[model samples]
Target chain A: MSETTIGGIAGRMPKFIRRADPAVVTAFACIVLLLFLGSLYSRSFLSPEYLLQQLKVASFLGVIATGMMLVILLGQIDLSVPWSVAVGAMMAAAAAAYGPVGAALAIPFGICCGIMIGIVNGIGVAYLRIPSMIVTLATNAVAQGLMVVYTGGFSPQDSATGAMRYLATGFAIPGVPNAVIIWAVIGAAMVFVLTRTGFGRSVYGIGNRERAAYLSGIDTRRVVMIAFAVSGGLSAFGGVLLAGYASKAAQSMGDAYLLPSIAAVVLGGTSILGGRGSYLGTVAGVILITLLQSILSVMQMPEAGRQIIYGVVIVAMLLLYGRAPASR
Target chain B: MKDWRYWLAEQRGTLLALAIFIVMFAIYTANHPAGFTANVVQTASNKGVLLAFVAMAQTLVVITAGIDLSVGMIFTLTNCLASWLVIGTGLETAFGVVAVLGTGLLCGAINGAIVIYGRLQPIVATIATGAVYFGIALLLRPFPGGSVNEDLADALTGRLFGVVPASLVALFAVVLIVWVPFSRSVLGRAAYAAGSSETAAYMSGVPIRRGKFAAYALAGLLAAIGGLFLTFFTYTGDAAYASGNAYTLFSIAAVVLGGVSLFGGKGSAIGAIFGALAFRTIGDLLFVFDFDPLWQPLFQGVILLIAVSLGAFALFRVRNRLEWFL
Candidate 1:
């Protein structure tokens, strides 16, 4: 190429980059790369059935990530996911043991437990002015302690109800998993809410600049509280599903989901700083993380290695996309 | 009158933290079957000092408006490294100590480089590096069997002059050597400036990048010191994941209790030290009170929430409402 042409292309590169959503692009690219790597590790990794199973697994993370994304988008966070999930699963399982009414109310009761936690989280952040990080973390400890006391510090005695098991492990249509279907319904609802509603606009506004949103009559506090509540409920729902899959609730069962949920949300290109992101990006992120996880496990990499990779991916992505303009 | 009031306001957080520690320690000693003796004090100091060091490490980063989730991992890594190196002859042990501490400095430097130069967020960057540090720790002590020099370990952890705890003395010396100089230094002031308002700091020509980098790097060094102490106390290294995570979380709690603001640019390491002591006392209180082990987490959480909520009372005076977001 001519010198002038090369210079022109270089000069235009920043502009073109600015127009593309880095989170969505990076997530999709990672997914493709992970898929290729997975196939290389095991031929069956490329099969439709294997991929579908991965999607089913991703669905749980997806459900939780959806909630996390809502909070992150509001420039706040919910660290209560671990215990919230535990509460949901434990409550659902415990309620399931009582008979027909208990079984029927299991899911709602589980979700209600989560919403309650979320509301408390919301009150702390919105009204008391406590940093969400501290409040949620404190609440998480409280939940853990409460659960331990409730269970007498042993494994919970209750097992998942038949319906709970069906929701988690059962197939709905010929080949599709029920978990995937649930995730899709949630995802679709979220996409619609984020794209078409005043609440969505309010969330984006509040995330971008809370004071500005409030000045513009957004009722920012209410939006934040509701966002947290939704996050809590969804996280608990994810926990309930996990309990269903595992057939019982165990102490510290929700402990594993906290970091991965944040990872998935950020991986999908949702800005950890909030105010800008799409659920589509989050979906891509969830799939990519799941695939990366599968590939790593297939290689017999240890848990420590998996955690390191997970952390690295998050840092790497932030480096790639989170940087502000150099000229500034 | 005005000057003294201003001074009081400036020192309020530290004073509050100190008051909390004093009250908690007093209650703890009063309830103890053994009462307040050197043996009891030594044991408590040994436990409290480890967290105090870690909290001090956390304090530096928090002052710059950043958090180091990796401090705990760095503590674990150094512990593991110390177990392997802090052994043999006097000169050899000395060199081993330097090596372990140096590794910690390097870990902190990496975090600083990524956050300051690479422009990544502190929370995410540290989380990633923390994982890497834990991974190395796991590799070093997969089965948790390694030893430190017995002479060095006992000397550090044991009582000094049969009265005061050696660990407390060591902790004070560290505060004198590391924190005092850093807090007075230009870079330290720069860190405060940056945390308070980075844009203003930048506009005023403060070396915000250097200040933040120093805070992060020093944080790693402090965490490493905690690790060395861990090795001394335990005489072995175990790559305990839960323990590491717990330390990270508790450090934040300690910082808050110490009067360090999460929003940054405030508070003293001394306060955080006392906060660490006070928090450790909460657990001891549970033990002495004969509470069920199961109630410990719940009580700790409740106490932390209450302690932190005390800091939030000032928000009620905020009139603009916009300041709430800040």
Candidate 2:
């Protein structure tokens, strides 16, 4: 059962449910089921406009999950995504308050802050040898503290740049959203990096067996560090897009995305243990989560019930294909 | 190894945790406006023991090389539950407390079964279960306005015999009744073996699953005990999501400070209690020193970074790069 999923070469998964990444097939099936269930509540659920809106919303989570997938691919995790997202948006908005050059720098400056945080996370995990969970946790706290200090007990006054707003909401295509384009671009990059590049192989290698990877002459620590850095940058970008979507930055804005992104990635069928997963599955998972969330809201489900369903879904998915083998 | 060496090694983490708590507490008291008064001690104990209990719960799961992110959620869930049920007559209050503890047990058992029997990794599994627990908590007290039996609350939270803190007494008794028994039992040893080397433990005929299941279940019970105390202290329940997450994070910090290995099989709950108390004082230190309370997060983060880094010094000593995998 376990051996089939490992040594996953791209295109190796046949389209059939029996041989395909079981989690991916399950996720798509769940997506269809959710759409059917949603249509039962409102015909708007299957309407093109509503579906596009869902994709736009799913884009934010999708970007964040992109980072999560990379880290999870290396069999590590970055718990700092929440605060990284916050810092990125806040800093971008903060930077935009300066002038034209500052406005131009705003996006990079925001992303840079996330990269800086990622580098710190990388150092802790790669060099310091601290567990990724704890180190990212500490960095998250630090980023949070920095934001609080910058804001000084109030919501950020700086607003998203006009460009930021346009990128998030404007129709870059006649009917498609700019945010969806951005997500597709990034998703394609991730697919390429994971499927064709040496870096991707190193990630799978390290996740599967760190010692073996190290002995094989791979710079394991550097790969681990870069994976975390990439995760950090994407999380920050997710925040940036979110700020643009809302047109302003606020305290705790990133909080809502944290659990959902994680839930989305795992739902997409990536193993929590790291070495096995597909980008297509993550895309499917993000849509599934977005639809599930939107439908639940449409049904007027309370926050408590939503949380329970989210938890149950993640647990169920993990049970479906992410279980640890007894040997470990 | 010599007899004393083994004994010393076993007690080292506990002793260090105790010593750190003592030093931090002494400084806190020395600098306080109230000095070393009974009231000061009482307030500190009341606040510290809440975390102390949660940390003990985390310690149980961590010892088995598993983590329960749901501990803080369980603490909050039971607190909300206790606020609703733990009121009115003495008999009714007893039943309420029992019901609250039982819910925690059930929540924990579900986590254990999911992770152990279903073979899911503990981290993601607990994260899911935690959401469920927190959701239940939110449903129970959507507006956070339930009350507890004041008499029971006061007796437990207030000073005992007008000198010592009642909470500290309860904490000690909990150690004796819960921790000591579990630590001495055969199951506990099996847990250690399983954590340190599951393959070896399995080969040696250890009851790995049973031991882990007990650890996870007991962790839930301990967290519920923490929840019960939280209700006693505030006399109400509020399902504040941020506070629940903070407690979960801080418990990990305490476990590290207590010398409990996140890697598992290396420390005691007694150490974790002291570690929790010490971590609480780290926050309280800002109040005494008159630092801007705003600096607390940054200050705490830096200290946590330092504390976890201490564990990394061992990495520097590894002669072979392969040893770094550990």
Candidate 3:
């Protein structure tokens, strides 16, 4: 009884609530919780039609997050996803106005833009000795300026080009969306690269310890640059599909993807400090976020509420991830 | 040239910017008489004051090798709260101001706690909080509308004596209060040491966690003060406030320009204030010169690139000089 006094009780309490490993547990719990919530609120949510539609929406984000995951795995970030996507879409639409060949050119052109920015980012962080965060932040500003200049604040249209319209708006599996198929293909390709390539190991190695990796004779700068290039090209691809989805490219369409892509990568249990995540995890994370977003939007929560909840959920997930024991 | 390191060590960017400022001012005066009048001076001074405070807030956190993306959010939150709290409380208007500052402190402290205790990286933690803070502001005033009490706004925004704005007095007071604590105290010294090297500082027996928390809290307070004064300029709270966005980028630019290393440590509050003023002056000069609106963003981006390049060049020169000495 004497030992159970206030001071004694306080001294015995643990610093934080003990948590299970977030890698598998948190991901599993979120998926189940989301499914339960969605089913409880709207039975239609579980319907095949609704589920497929959700998959379709998640696919575009999933594809983008796949690239984002690769970049994050290298322990760096790209903030220009939204603008890059917007530019890709607008350029694609504008190219299609020329012909099918022109539309095809937009894809490479967009990828080239991504590669250029990636190279710049890599070089600045590597040789020029600038932080990736600062470099990317500046690039975002530059891209936004370019967008404003090229579009003059107007949304570009594919109204004159049937090819562009068909590319973006056309359906692929009767009721299933084309975006989902493209997303699956990209995700599969990323899995292959991550598992098989020497560059992939170099990326993880650099993220884990740059000095060690450099001393080990890996061209750390080159690997980082390639990571950025891959991220850039993938984001551009997403942008192309986004153009297809919207049927027209808008000035700020790319802005919305920035937070979600990052969130998806982290929530999938990838460490923010880098070198510890997978595309599969990112896919699951993308699905989680996309679903959460749809449910909230459908419930007609105020924009403010949705944003607040989004922030809270993301932070909560990260906290959980931090507390959970590492499985490996 | 071999001694360039010695020159750069003294922060050449600040000196160069000052020279540029003077040249621009001389040109402006040559073009228009009365451009240096009290009214014009006060207007420009007031704008610079707001940016200076925001930059100071940014500088404090960045010194800790962290960033508070939520600073802008805190500014908007304080503004929204001011509009709501000032209108109907029995508390004196002064207390209302205190409450707003307190709110900012609390917001920043929460961010600090999450960053430290939650073990989240500074960037991701703040990004989330930024969203939450902005969301809360929007929730409070779903639409872009709310008025500050007219009397309070007047006293804060109006002139104190002979065309010197009341805002300037408040601004100077902030500088005094913050500068002393930041430069003269043991805690201040510890902060610098900690920022320079976290591991070394920890080994030297500095309270690393406490120092970080204090830096973030101070940043929050400064952001709040900036927001409060901003209310006088706008006379109302708008949910779609652009103040936060302007402060976010401008604060970083100012810090970098003032010779604050982005990797943390080696910066001065006074220098940051000057950097903020320089940035404001550049924008104002363009307005005075009547540059095209369409050209402004492109021009600004180009200017920022040049500024960054110059900063890097100066750093490089300094490094080369150091090698020569060795």
Candidate 4:
């Protein structure tokens, strides 16, 4: 009976299906499915303009997920994304209100704030030996509190600068969005770092076995710290882009991205436990999620239902690929 | 070294949590205008017990080296369920209560099934399950207008003999009925064994899967109990997303504060309960001192950071650098 069950399944499927990264397969399948479903729902849904818009929207999540993927690859997590994103957006908007020098510094300032938070997160995890979950969570709370105090229990007053708006909304190359271009640049850099750089190898090595990596002379602490810092900076950059898109940063703007970022990374097939995954998969995963969200919204699904679907997809993907033999 | 010293070392987290709660509560009451009156104590217990119960739920899963992010959503779902069902005649109310708790159990069982049989990571599984639970809760009370059994709510949220809070009594009974037996049972030992080292537990023939399932299921039940209390206090149910998320986050903070190792296999619900109480007191401390409510999150974050830092100090004692990863 068992033989028939196994053989039946194997006989009916292409051999490549069994070996392909489950994340990539699932992501591509979901994208195709969503597109078909979307086209059926509305004829305009499959248009080049609409699809490009979707890609543009996905670029925000993709940028954030790149950083999240790196941290997850190291088997560490950064819960501080919500506030880091907020801090980045808030500081950028606040600085932009100061004029040219402030505008020039706005992006760097927001990224720097994120890097600073990441360093704090790194110190706690790498030096103090605190769990990344708790440390990042606490830092997130601190960042939230600081922002709240800064905003004084009201919406931030500063608006996005012209540069910020242009970056988020403008078309630099004909018919292509700047956000997509930015995402592509970031994605290319991540691919290089992951596939070529020693730092990338160190991230995977540490994720697979931190102790083993350390014994093998990898500076595990430094890798963890840098990875966290990059994750922080990237999340912040995503927030800046979002603020630019919205024309202003608002309180709790980053709150919505936290789970979606994780979902994108995990869906892309990076193991939540770390040390296994690919940027290509994450890229696909981000696009898939963005498409899913767009389709769901177009169908007039409620926010609650969308959230449920998002969660279910993550769990489903985990069951598909998260159960592979333990690396340790 | 003596056996008691070893015992003390094992329970240092719980003891520290207990001490922190006492000190913080004392300071809170000392500065309050009510001056530690029964009313003040009762009010505190009523508020603290909600978090205490949720923290206890978190403790069960954390003890097994896993986490249940769905705990708060379960709490919210049950609260919503109870508001709709836990009303009318006494017998009817009893049945409604059972159904609500049963739903919680079922939700938890689903979480367990997915994590164990489906072979997903606990965090991701719970996150997914949590969203589902929250979605159901939103469906149940989209506009947040349902009444529970008012008499039951008042009785439970009110004082016992005009001194001890009835909620405190309920919390104590739950500890005795749910926590004590579970902590002492064979499955409980299996859970601990599994958490401390799953491979070792499997080799030793421990019922790791069953133990973990129990932990997850029981965590859901405990969270539901917390939900029932929330209904009792508010006399209604509201599917407030922020509140649900806060409970989930706070439960983790409480567990850590109670000295339960996030790494798993070491700590107790009792410790977590105390941690929850102390964490609640930190907010009260701000209120009494006339600090702006805006500062509460910052203060809570700072305190949590300092408290968790206390646990990290032990790592500095390790000689080998690789041990840091562990």
RMSD versus native structure for model 3: 7.4
Maximum-DockQ candidate: 2
Cα displacement (angstroms), candidate 4, residue B3, comes to 4.7
**Compared with the true structure, what per-residue lDDT tens digits does model 3 show for residues A1-328?**
1232111223344532122223544676787799889899989988989888888888878877887888788777887687777767777667767767776676666557766666666665555556666666666666666767777766765532454445445676777577777788888888777766787778777778777787788887778777877777777777777776776778777767878999888888777778776665687788899988999999999889988999999889888764423212
What fraction of the true interface does each of the listed models get right, in terms of native contacts kept?
0.63, 0.73, 0.35, 0.57
Tell me how each candidate scores on DockQ against the true complex. 0.61, 0.76, 0.31, 0.56
TM-score, model 1 to reference: 0.95
Number of the candidate with higher DockQ, 1 or 2: 2
Per-residue CA lDDT of model 2 for A1-328, tens digit only, reads 3345453446645535344677788899999999998888788888999999999999999999999999998889889999999999999999999999989888999899999999999999999999989899889988988888788869998999988998899997899999999999999999989877999889988988899999999999999999999999999998899999999998898888878888888888888888888899899989999998998899999999999998998888778777777764
Q: Looking at model 1 chain B, which ten-residue stretch has the lowest summed lDDT?
A: B303-312
What is the clash count for each candidate, in the order shown?
Answer: 0, 0, 3, 0
Model 4 lDDT tens row, B208-315:
889989998999999999999999999889888778978998899999999999888999999999999999998789999998888888888888777777777787
Each candidate structure's TM-score, on Cα atoms with residue i matched to residue i, is: 0.95, 0.97, 0.88, 0.95
Candidate with the greatest TM-score versus the true structure: 2
Q: What is candidate 1's CA lDDT for residue B221?
A: 96
Give lDDT for model 3. Answer: 0.74
Winner on DockQ between 1 and 3 is 1
Please report how far candidate 2 places residue A125 from its true position, in Å: 0.5
Ordering by lDDT: 2, 1, 4, 3
Which stretches of candidate 1 lie above 4 Å from their native place? A1-20, A325-328, B1-5
Kindly indicate the candidate among 3 and 4 with the higher DockQ. Answer: 4
Instruction: Evaluate model 1 with DockQ and give the value.
Output: 0.61
